[model samples]
Target chain A: MSQFSDPDATGPMAQGVAIFGEFVENAQGVTATVAVIGKKNEPLYLRLFDEYQTKELYFQSLVFVSLDVIDECVERKAMQQDMYLGFLCPIDEYQIYGYMTNSMIKFVVVLADVHRLQDFELRDFFQKVHAAYVEYLLNPFAPLDGDKIKSARFDAAIERHVATILERPPPAPGPGAKA
Target chain B: MSASANARLGEQIWQKMPKINAEFFTLTYGAMVVQLMRDLEDVQLVNEKLEKMGHSIGCRLIDEFLAKSGINNCNEFAETADVIAKVAFKMFLGVSVEVASWNDEKTSCSLLVYDNPLTDFVELPPNINLYYSNVLCGVIRGALEMVQLRVECYFVRDTLRGDDVNEIRLELKEHIKDEMAEEYRRE
Candidate 1:
C-alpha cells in the first residue's frame, strides 16, 4: 500500500484526502499534457507526461490555468487559433500552444524554456500525438470510448516526444549571474 | 531515361529503403480516422484533423524524400507530379499511382489511385462522414507547398469512401516566389 493512500497519514487533508505532494509549479519543471473537455463544458480527462505526472494536483490546477487563457481568448475575440500563451517567466519560460478542432476537442501543448520550435516542428509533434492516439484506439484490449488512456505504449510515446523539447537547467545559476 | 530505367530506379529505391508491414501502415491510418470519429463525434471535424495530421506528416517526410531521392530540382510541375506518383509513392508505399486527365494548359491534373495502401481490407460504414484516406491529401498539399508550388490537392473521389475510383485532383494556384516563400510556410 502506498503511504499517500493510507487513511492514517496526517499532513493536510482535502475532502478526506491527504496531500503528499503539494501542487508544484516545476513538478516536472518541463511538462506536457493532452486535455479533453467534455460536451458538458466540464473537464473530462487529461493525459499528463513526465514530472507533470508526479505533481498531479499542481498540474491539474494548471489545466484550469491554461483554460483561463482560452476563456480570455474567446472573450477578447482574438485570433486564438494556432496561438501560444506565454506566462510564468523568471521562474521558467512557459508557452502553451492551444489548437481546437471544429468539433471542440481542444489540443494543447505546454512547453518550458525552449522557444526554438518552428511551426513545422510543432506540427510534427502534434502528428506524433495523433499517431499515439490512433495507436491506443486500435488496441482491442483497450476500452473503445473512455476518458483515460490506459496504454503503456502511448505513455512511453508521450515521455519520448516530450523529452525532445526539454531545456537544460538555465546554466545552474552560474557565478556572477543572478542566483 | 527509358521506361525500364525508371522502373529500375523504383525497384532500387524500394530494395534499399527500410520497409514495414503494409498492415501496420493501414492500421495506423485507419485507427487515426476511427479515433477521430470515436472522440470528436463530428464528421467535418474528423476530416479537418485528418488532413491537419497528414499535413504535419507531409512536411516532415518531404525533407526525407528530397534527401533520399537525390533528384535534381524539377524543371516543371509536370515532372514534380510524376516524381511524387512514381518515386515517392513507390519508395514509401511500394506502389505507383496513375497520373492522368490533365486539364487545358496542363495547369491541373488528376491522379487515379487504383490501390490505396492506407485502406487495405478496411471499409467505411454507411451514414458516416469520413475521409478515410485524407492523409494523402495532406501529404500532397504539404510536399508541394514546400517546393514553392502553390497547388490545391484534394480527393475528388476515394475508394475507401465507396467511390468507383480513387481520384486526387491537383490544381496549380500560383508560383510562390522565393522572396515571399516564408509567408506560405505556415499556412
Candidate 2:
C-alpha cells in the first residue's frame, strides 16, 4: 500500500523495518529522528513526531532545519540560545521553535514552552540539542523521525558522533590480510 | 546621553549600566555570594559587611542615574525614592518595585521578587541577621535614607523554603528635615 513497501522499488527497501529497529534501540523511552523539509514547511523525509507516540523526553518538541532557513528565520525572530548556533521563530499554535543550521543541514526544534528555561539553562540545553542533531545526521539507516530525538542523551550522542567524524582518521586494513 | 552612532562615552556607560548584561552579572555574583556564605562560619558579621558594601555601591549608582536621565532634581522625598528603586534596580539587578505606601513624610516600597540570581537555592539560617542577600535591602535603605528618609526593610520570606516565591518588603519610615543631626548621633 505505502510506497515504502512497493515490491518493484529498486535498491534497499523495507516496511516496518525502521519501526522494529526503533522498538529495540529506544528502550529508555528516548528516540531521535530526522527529516528533510520542502517548501511551505512541508516535511519531505521521515518524520518522528508522527510515528512514536509513547516515548517522552524533556525537550518534547524540537525541529531541525537547514542553515539557510535558519538565516531567514533569524531575520524575523530571536535566537533562543547564543551559545548554540540556532535561530528561533514563534509559531502561534506551537508556542516556540528553535531553527538550527550548520554547513550540512537545517534543523527546526519546536517546544511546548521555553520561557521556563533561564538564559544559561537554555544555552546549555540548546548546545546538547545541537550535538544530537549531528549524531542523527551521521547514522545512515537511523530513521529520520523528524522530531523524535528529544532526549539529552540523543544530543550527547550527536556530540560524540561529531567528535568522531571530525577526529577519526580513515580506516586502515585489518590484520594485513587484504592488499 | 548622546544619540550619535560614534558616541564612545555614551556607549561605554550604556554597557557598564549592568542591565545590558544583568543576567550574567547576577548569576556570577549570586554564585559567589552563595559560595561565600556556605564556606564562611560567621554569617552575622558577613551579612553586615555585605550590607555596608551595598550601601557604597548604591551611592555611586545614584550618580550614574542622574547623569543618564538628565533629571534636574527630585521634587519630594517620595519622588527621590521612586527614582532610586526604579532606575537603580532596573540598571543593576534587572528588577522593578511596587510602592505599597507613600505619604508626604515617609514611604514604603516592596521589591516583588521575580527571578533573582542572589535568591537561588538560598536558605535563611534560623537567625534573622544571617541573611546574605540582605545586602540588596541595605542598598535600597542606605541609599535613600542618606538623603533624609527613614527606611525599614526586610525579607518577606526565606527563599530556601522551596514552596513560596520570594518577596523583599521595604518600609520607608518617615522624613527627617535635619539628616545631619541623626548622622551625628550615630557617628
Candidate 3:
C-alpha cells in the first residue's frame, strides 16, 4: 500500500515508483506524474514517478492544479480539432502538459525541469497515451463514472510506453537544442 | 435459401446501413456494462439486467430488420437459423457467425461467434462468473419470438471465459401458429 492517498496503488506505477528511485537522481526528461481526468474533472487515474517518493502528495496536487488551465485551453480553442493542449503552467520545478480527448477525458503529464522537450515529442507522447486510454476504456470492467483505474495491464502499458519515450537519446546539439 | 445467398444479402444490407464509429460503439457498450456492474453490485443481477435491456431492443429491431431487408418469412427452422447466423448477425454487428452442432432432431443448434465486438478488449478477472455477452442471447430470443418462433437461447461457451470461441446454443421450443377469431380469419 502507498503512503499517499492515491485511489488505487496496486498498479505497476506504484511498484516502479517504490523501487526505481535510485536512478531518478540522474533522470533527465523523466515523467514526474501522469493523470487521467474524467469529463466531470474527477481523477480517474493518477501516478507519481518523482525521484523523491515522499513527494507524492505534491505531485498529485500539481496534476489537480492544472485542471483549470486545461479547461481554459479547451474553452479558448473550442473550434480546434487538435487534442494536444500543449504546455500548461510550470510550478516550482516541474512543467505540466495537457491533452484532451474527443469525449472530454483529460490527460496531464508533469515532467521535471531538467530538460525541455520539443513540441512534436510532447504531441507524440500525448497521442500514445490517448491510444492507451481508449484501449483502457474498452475494458468492460473499467468504471466510466470517474472511478480510479485499477487494471494492471493498463498500468503496465503506460509504464512500458513511457519508458520507450524516455529512453530516446538526447537530440543532437544543434542551434535548436540550445533551449 | 443457400448460405451464399444469405451472406450476399447480409453484405448488401451491411453496406447500406448507416454506420457509427466502431470505437464509439465499443466504448459506449463498455461504459454501460461498467455502470450496470456498479449499480447492481451483484454480477448475476447485472447480467440479467443487460439481457433484459437487450430483449427490449431486440423486440423493436425485428420490425426495422424486416422492413429494411424486405424478407417475408422463413419456411423452415434451418432457413431461419441460416438467416440469423449469416444475415441478421452480419447486418447488425458486421461480423459473421457459423451455425454448427445441430442435433439429430433439428431442434437445437449452436452459433459460433469468432469475433465478437462486445468482447473486444475485455479481459475477465479470475473466479468471476459474469457473462459479459449474455445480452446477445436475450436479443436472439426476443427477436425470434417476435417472428413467432419461440426458442431457448443461452451461452454454451464464451471466449471471455477462455473458450476458443463464443458459442450460443439456441433450441427451438415452440412455433406459434396463427390463431385468430372467425371474423378476423381470412376466407
TM-score of each: 0.49, 0.40, 0.63
After TM-score superposition, what is the CA distance of residue A80 in candidate 1 from its true location, in Å? 63
lDDT per residue for candidate 1 within A1-179, as digits (tens), equals 11222365342234122222233434345355555543333554556655334444433444556666666665574555643333322222446665444445554666544455676676766667656655655543344443455444555555565556444332232222211
| Model 1 chain B: ten consecutive residues of lowest lDDT | B1-10
Predicted candidate 1, C-alpha RMSD:
19.6
For every model in order, the TM-score on chain A comes to: 0.55, 0.35, 0.75
Q: Specify the CAPRI tier of model 2.
A: incorrect
Q: What lDDT does the true structure give each of the candidates?
A: 0.63, 0.47, 0.80
Write the number of the candidate with greater TM-score, choosing between 1 and 2: 1
TM-score on B-chain, cand. 2: 0.63
Error of 3 at B47 (Å): 2.7
| DockQ of the candidate models in sequence | 0.02, 0.02, 0.31
DockQ: which candidate is best?
3
* Candidate 3 ranges with C-alpha deviation above 4 Å: A1-119, A134-141, A144-146, A163-179, B18-41, B72-76, B118-128, B159-164, B174-187
